[model samples]
Target: MTNRLVTLFKFGIVGVANTTVDAVMFALLAVIGVPLLIAQVISYSCGVANSYWLNGRWTFRDAAREGNERAKLIRFLITNLVVLVLSAQILMSLHNMLGWSLVMSKTLTTLMGMVLNYMASRYWVFRLAIK
Candidate 1:
């Protein structure tokens, strides 16, 4: 496979791990009476943390410019913040307004977030530096 395709494949692997962390955390929190929005935030944060570390170290390692860990982190945070707000709103709308199950709502939001995240991470947060 080409380099870009390889990076994308690695990203998919990391995404699976991140999603597992997020879904499990969210389910645990929500099952124990935590507020839905709060649970979503907490769980998404867990996933974001995982995404940053793994994507930086593995998926985007080749593209990463050296000595800019802090900058990359800041960019990752900004990207994820945008993703979180959108996902949370969608989750709420699906569950509360449209009478969807929490699982279904979360699944939908997660998928949407995955796409947004991959784009932002590839083209912005972890953009390849022009040489």
Candidate 2:
């Protein structure tokens, strides 16, 4: 339990850093006149790679899976895609049904997605090493 909590703490720290990276990239792309959707895709991809590196090195180091590096990266990307879908649903529910402000909805979405991301990273992307 304590270890899990510690992992969560590390994950949160990495998340904050990755979120900042995403926002900065998105803002830079937008300011340079990239279309909003294009900017979002580019920024989100940046965050995905950042998440994998930080989480692998710091957040779930003990759980890092033993496998081909390419396979691990592929799994990480797929997990993030699922996380994005779930977060989109949460955001719609919070913003549309619950009448939350856009910022509030997004904040909630990010928090919820973090849980999924951690679980997937631990059990799937970074599963305990084979003996």
Number of the top candidate by TM-score? 2
lDDT of 1 by residue, 1-131 (tens): 48778887988999999989999999999999999999988997898899899998888886675647788889999998898789889999999999999999999988888889889998888886512
Candidate 2 local lDDT, residue 32: 95
Off by over 4 Å in 1: 22-44
lDDT of candidate 1 at residue 21, scale 0 to 100:
98
lDDT values for all models: 0.88, 0.87
If scored against the real structure, what TM-score would every candidate get? Answer: 0.74, 0.89
Worst 10 residues of 1 by lDDT: 122-131
Compared with the true structure, what per-residue lDDT tens digits does model 2 show for residues 1-131? Answer: 88778877998899998999999999999999999999999999898889999988778766564567787788999999999999999999999999999999998898889989988887888876612
Clash list (residue pairs), candidate 2: none
